[model samples]
Target: MITQVQVKGLMFDPYNNAYIVILRDDEQSEMLPIWVGKSEASSISLALENVAPPRPMTHDFMKSYLDAFDAKVISVVITDLNENTYFAKIHLTYVDSEYTVDARPSDAIALALRSHAPIFASESVIRKQSSEELDQWLENLKPEDFGKLDS
Candidate 1:
C-alpha cells in the first residue's frame, strides 16, 4: 500500500554530496528521507523558495507541456526500493485515460509540487527506513539541541 506524504524540508547530507528530501505522513506520523542530487535539490529548493528562473527550467517546461496537452498529474508514488535505490512513478490523467510514467523520486517530487499533486511512498519503504513517529521524535529534540550542532 502507498501512503500519502508531504515534503517536510530539504537537508544536506555531506557524505554523498546529496540533498535529503524529508517527507512526512501526518496520519501515520512518520518521516522518510530520500537522498537526491544537487541539481534536483536546487530545483526543489527553487520551487520552495518561490524563486522563478529567468528561463523555464526542465520541470517548468514539463509542467507547461503537460498543461498544454491537457494532461493533469494525479499523484506521484515512491513505489519501490532496491539495493538502497528508490523508484517512483507519476500518475497522469488526460480526458478519460490515465497513464503512469517512470521517474526518479527527485524529479517526481519536483513535478508533483509544480502540478499540485499528492506524494506517496510505499509502506515497505517507510518500514525500511525505520522512521519513528514524528511527534515522538520532536518531543525528544529541543530547539537548542539542534542549535549547537554543526551543519
Candidate 2:
C-alpha cells in the first residue's frame, strides 16, 4: 500500500552541503524529512515559490522532455529507506503505456511539482521513516537558512 504525501517544507543545514526536505502525509499527521543535495533543494524551492528563473533549470528541462513526448507523470513514490539512504520512483503514463523509473526522492519531487503530480510513499517506508508529528516551529524557518543552495 502507498499513502499520498506532499512537500511540506525545505530546510537547510549550513554546516554541510545537505538540505533537508519535509514531506507531510495527506492527513497531515506525519512528516518525513530527507537530506538532499543543494542544487536539488533549490530546484524544489523554485517550484514551491513559483519562481521562474531567467533560464530553465535541470528539472525544468525534464518537464520539457515530458511535454514533448506527451508523457504525464502519474505520481512519484518514495519507496525505500536503507542505511540513511532513500529511494524513489517516478510513475508515468505515455501513449497508454505505464512506466516506472528509478530516481532520487529529491529529483522525483522536483519533477513531480513541475508535472502537477501527486507524491506518495510506500506504507512500509512511511511507517519506518516518518515522524508521528511535524515540527511545530518549521513554519518559522526562513529561506536564508538555505544558504547558497542553488549552487
Q: Supply candidate 1's per-residue lDDT for 58.
A: 88
Model 2 lowest lDDT segment of ten: 132-141
Pairs with backbone N, CA or C atoms under 3 Å apart (clashes), candidate 1: none
lDDT of 1: 0.82
Per residue, candidate 1 scores C-alpha lDDT tens digits across 54-102 of: 9888899999999998999999999887765788999999999999999
TM-score (C-alpha) between model 2 and the true structure: 0.85
Alpha-carbon RMSD, each predicted model: 6.5, 5.3
Please list the C-alpha lDDT of all candidates, in the order they appear.
Answer: 0.82, 0.84
In candidate 2, stretches whose alpha carbon ends up further than 4 angstroms from where it belongs are 132-151
